[model samples]
Structures are given as C-alpha cells and as structure tokens.
Target: MPVENSRIKGLYKQTVQERLKLVAKAAGLTDEHVQALSNHGELDDVAADRMIENVIGTMSLPVGVATNFVIDGKHYLVPFCLEESSVVAAASNMAKRCLGHGGFTTNNDEPVMIGQIQLLDVEDFEQATTNILQAKHELITFCNDVPSRMIALGGGCKDLEVRRLNTHMGSMLVVHLLVDCRDAMGANAVNTMAERVASRLEALTGG
Candidate 1:
C-alpha cells in the first residue's frame, strides 16, 4: 500500500518528481521548461528552437535576494535582478553593514506625469490661451476623463499651464497638463490625453 502525504501547512512530504512538477506549475513555465528538461543530456548540435519566442536566443542574468531587512520591525527579502558583475555581491555586503545599524529606509515620491499639447497655427494666440484658461474648469473635467481604475483613484489631471513661444512655423502655444498617476507607468495615458487636448486646441484656434 502506498502512503499519501498531504500536510496543509509548513512542511509536507513530496517525492522529487512531485516537487519539480509543483515548482514548474507554480512558476507558470512554458514549453521552454520542457526543452530545458530535455537538454539535461548533452548532445552535439542539439537544435531545440521550436519552443520559444524571439529566439535569436535567451540571455542569462544573475539574480539575488537580499535578506535581513527590517521595516517597522517587519522582515523583508528584497530580490534584485541584475546582470552587472559583482552587483549582487556588493549589495549583500552593504546590506550586512546596514543590518546592525538598523535596516535601510526608503521613501518614494508620488509618480506624477506631464502631458504637452502643442497648439500651432492659431488665429489669436493670446485670446486662445485666455479662452482655454477661462474654461479651466471644463478643461480639467475633460482631462480627468480617464477609464483606468489606477488613474481614477483621484489622481488624474491636477493643473494645466500654457507656454507661448516663437518658432520657424510662427508663434505656437504649448499646453502642459500635469497629472498624478497613483501606481501605474502613465506614459500612455499622458500621451493620449495630450493628443486629445491638441485636437481640441486646434479646433479652438482654427488650426
């Protein structure tokens, strides 16, 4: 009779094959893992290129997780993936030095982004800018019309600025919209809003 080991917590008994399968599944590995497994036996000219994408080939980088970090007395293991030589070793040494003198502390600035709308071929530049400024309430309302949950967390458009400059293509005004993006990389959102605003500005300025 075979025994089944299914402990719910902490430690459980599993065969080597069972553990490997569990790890492979948990890691969300693709067919690449299968090929790597197949390549355990070295062969001359083993061409296994059917299992990956953009396979000019894959590159390897050394990854390290540093321990002994305490934030408000809570321990953390911060992992870093880097390919630079000796970076991992240097980080390990620095972390060791900081552990005894209280763990490292860090704070981040709120990720805010700026969107620019260039208004060219204006009828009356000053009046156009004034019109935009007078309609600030409406403009801000329109700018905050983002459809993402991250952007909708009261972090859409904050303010708008107008910059007048002279160029070879005549005098142009660049409208700058500052946006606060809570946790997302907001480049796409910023650019999209900028383009929309540019179109609206062109309509207003007869461009």
Candidate 2:
C-alpha cells in the first residue's frame, strides 16, 4: 500500500509496535523485511557473534521514523536508529516545511573516491614520485586487472597520483587511487584495490 501523504501527525504518541506496523504498511515492506526489523533487527546474539570480534552483546536503541519526505515525487518514511532525542522530530518538521515546494528531489553525482597506499622510508621522494608517474598507466591497469562488475560498468580504478606527506614520524610517499564506484560505497572496492597494488607500489618506490 502506497501512502497518499507523507505527513503523519501524532506518530510519536504511538507505541513502538504500533509505529512499526504503521511504517510497515506505509512502505509496503515485505513480511521478511518486517520480521527483520523486529527482534532487534536480525541482530541477535547469534548474529552479533558472527558479525564482529569479541561480541559481548547487542545494545538496544530506539528506532524512530521521520515522516513527510517526498524525494523524486516518491513518498518515503526514513527511519533513524540513534540514542539522540529530538533529531527525528526535527527532521519530520523540516520535511513538512518542504512539502509545499514539491518536497525533496535528487540529483545523482559521480561517486568517485580516493584510496591511499602509504610508502614509508623513501630515500628519494623526488625519484620515487617520478617512477610512479611514469608507471601510472601500468599501475591503474594492475588495479583493474581482476575481472569485476564494477569495471565492466565503467567504474573502477580510473586515475593515479603520487605525493609526499610529512608526518610526525617522517616524510612518507602516498599513492592515491581514484576510482569511480558507481552507485555503491567504494570502501570494499577501494580497499581491495589498494591492498592489491601495495606490493607493486612498494617495489616501484623501493620503500
């Protein structure tokens, strides 16, 4: 069921279960999605043990929904899980104010990010930087050497750079890998590429 209006008054007065049902109906969440949102959101003792290290337990937090959002002409009830109070109220209030102006819209931007490879104990920063620049094409190719859906979709290691950063420890050579991550957060892709190219970068710089 689609919601006719994003604005919903007195939502905070409802109980947690009541609010969950309301939001579930409004968003047309599947039964599985609704069940996942229940029981601390698929994050019980077993899940906690599998997810991270030294799992003691999972702490419960208040899950609040911020209503009155219309992005790209589609109504959405954004949910927030945090300890902070009044934040959800503030967001819902802001959405009501913007609802008169056709609500919020979206404009997609290229989601490119930079991943760094740190090289330490570089004796010749100038020479090392020069070597990296000369082999820029080769390094980029090496990063994208593995077959990937991201690379096939024209999003992968696209550019490279070498610079010197003076830290409290010493002046270290840093290699930046510019990657277009498409519609995803580039953490996994960027980090994997950086790790894959680390040995080569060290060899090139002799650091």
Candidate 3:
C-alpha cells in the first residue's frame, strides 16, 4: 500500500534526479546534498567529450523515464536511454497491462552446440567411417575422461554423427559431436572438444 500511496501522491511523478534527492534526504544526507547538486550542475562538455566516444559537442534530446514494470514476478524501474519519442510511454503502458494478469516469464535452454571435424587423406573412406563408428563409445568416454570442468557443470559431449562429403579435395568423412553445456556460453568448450576429437580421429585413421 505504501508504494501505491506514493504513486497516488505524485511522488513517483518526479524525475530520476528528484527521486534520488528524496532518497538522499530520507537517508539523512540533506545537509551535504547541496554540495552534490552544485557538483553535478557544474558538469560541462569538455569533461563529457573526454569520457564519451566521438562526443564533438552536446546533443539536445528529450529524456524520459518509464515506470511500473514486473519482469519474472519482480518489480523494476525500467530505464530507457533513447531520443525516440513515445517508445517509453508505450512500453510502460504495455507493462502495466501485463501486470494485471501476471508478470512476464523468461526461460533459457541449456547451451548445446555441435562441432564438425572433416577427415581426409584416408585410403578407404568407408573403412575409416566404420572405424570411427566403432570407436564412438571410446570417443565419448575420452571426452568425458578429460573431465572438462565446464562440461562437468551440466555440460558434456552427448552424441556423435558421421557425414560423407564429396568436395574438390575428394571424398571425406566429417564427424559431428554435440555437446551440452549446462549454464555456460559453451563456444570455447565445444571448439576444444571438436579439436580433441578431430586429433584422435586422425590418429585412429593413421592420418
């Protein structure tokens, strides 16, 4: 009710700096606040240009703040740094409407990626393919044996596939390994596993 009361009383109608001042006052920083305001008010283009990239001069734009956000059941004051008009107002209105039903829910899947290793220079492509197929279990075990700490955290090589490709370089068999990385971005892990598997596969084929 306190939040609703603050909204109804126009306390939420103030700008961000004004609200910050109110917060500082509530936190008993009223006496030192004048110095803070004076310091901020003295900011000029020379310092801003040094801090920002390609800031030749000051650009005039209307700054607005949006309120009433509920993302994943948590309330938030969404800030939009833009010069575009009506975007913030529209987004805020939509967020308010969605809050009546329920807040927005976001979900992310486990990061999994596939890497391909192309093997060439083999005497018998068919036999090489068969050899890799038979060694599939060992390959998987080898991947798990290295005990990739990243893979251990909800990540590991899961499946393997063989592909036959006919390029100008001649026919080659490409091996694809699918890795599941629980919470990580997984790019580096997938790439490392792919390289390791490729080396082992080359050795198996006596390449």
Candidate 4:
C-alpha cells in the first residue's frame, strides 16, 4: 500500500507515539513491525554479539519521518534513523519543494553486480585470457555449485569474463564474475564465491 499524501503539515510538532501511528497508517505497517520499531534496542546482548565481534552492547537511534515526497507519481513518507540532526527536516522541506515540479522521477536498470578476481604475476596474458574464456562455462558452474538459497531461487553466477589490465605495476589478468543476486544485496554470496574460487582461478591462470 502507498501513502496517499506525504505532505503532512507539522509532522515534527507531534509526539513520538503520534508520529508512529501516522507512519504506521501511511506506510501500511503491520502490528509486529510497528511494535519492533516502537521498541528500541530490541536486539539483546547475545544477539548483538552473534552479529559481530567485540559487541559491547546494542544502541538505538531516533527514527524520524521525512514527509512530503512524491516519486514516480507515488507519495511517500520516508523514515530516517540516524544520529545526524536536521537531516529529516531538511529532506522533508526539499521533498515538499519538489511537489510542484512533479516530484522526483526514476529510471532504474536491472539489478546486477560483478565480483572481480584479480590474478597477479601472470606469465602470458593472451594465454591466460584464452584459458579462462575456454573454461567459462565450467568456472560459472563451479561458482554456482554451492547449495545457496539464492542459487536455488534462480539467482547466481550467470556468466564469466576475462580482462587483461595493464596497470603501472605490471600486466595482470582480472576475471569478472557476472552474478545475478536477485533480491538480496549479493555481498555475502559474491564474497564467498570469490574466496572459494580463488584457488581454481589461480590454477587456470597460473597466477
């Protein structure tokens, strides 16, 4: 569900509970989501420790509503959760100013990211490039061999490319792994794949 009108006048003048209610209504938030947002620092010490190392504790930031935004003919009341002051008010004011100019428009391309595997100390650039290209299918298959949920959902390594970059240090081979991460950010998957396939790439390119 979309927000009907983002131009909520005097939204900052309201209390925290009032603003939360308004955000819940405009953003079509569920009861569980609303409860989680209302409850600050829901992440316990154990949970925070599991997330990262040296986890002293968890912290909470104030979430403010940046009102008056219309993008692609849709009204939106964006929420900003950070320590920086004046960001929410500034964004809200700017978004309101763009209301008369048809708001903001967008033309986004397909979501796809690349993982580069740099091969240093190569003997022959041409031979390495040829070798990698010839084994592109096998390399892609190897990268996708993992039992990843993303791969199961038809999102994984789609193609492979080999480039010979002539840096100031020397000429090295760079293998570009074309991966379709789908809905996820693809960092975890891409990083894992890169680390896993480094040995194989080295054997292929004699790096």
State the lDDT of candidate 2 residue by residue for 1-207, as single tens digits: 246666767776665556667777777778876666665744564453333322222345445667888888988777666556567778888988999899998897678999999999989999999999999999999999987888889899999988899989989999999999987787999999999999988888899
TM-score to native of every candidate shown: 0.57, 0.60, 0.56, 0.72
- Compose the digit string of candidate 1's lDDT tens values, residues 1-207: 011211112111333234334434434446776345334233211131222111111123222333345554444544344434455345555656776777667788778888988777777888888888887777877877768675657777778988788988788888889888788788887877787677676766665
Residue pairs with colliding backbones in model 3 are: 151-155
Q: State each model's CA lDDT, in order.
A: 0.57, 0.77, 0.61, 0.77
In terms of lDDT, the poorest run of 10 residues in model 3 is 1-10
Better of 2 and 3 by TM-score: 2
* RMSD of each predicted structure: 10.5, 8.4, 7.8, 8.0
Worst 10 residues of 1 by lDDT: 1-10
What candidate 4 gets wrong by more than 4 Å, as runs, is: 10-63, 82-85, 107-109
- Which residue pairs clash within candidate 1? none
Error of 3 at 141 (Å): 2.0
The TM-score measured for candidate 1 stands at: 0.57
lDDT of 3 by residue, 1-207 (tens): 012211112434554456445434433445455344324333443453233221212223223334456666666544453445567667767777787877578898656778888887777777887898899999987876676777567568988988788888788888889888777777887888888777899987755
Between candidates 1 and 2, which one is better according to lDDT? 2
CA shift of 105, model 2, Å: 4.8
lDDT tens digits, residues 1-207, model 4? 369999877666555566667778778889987777656576553443333322222246555667788999999877665556677767878988999999999996655678999999999888888888898888889999999999998999998788888988998899888889989999999988888888988998899
Model 1 error, position 43 (Å): 17
Residue 91 of model 1 has an lDDT of: 55
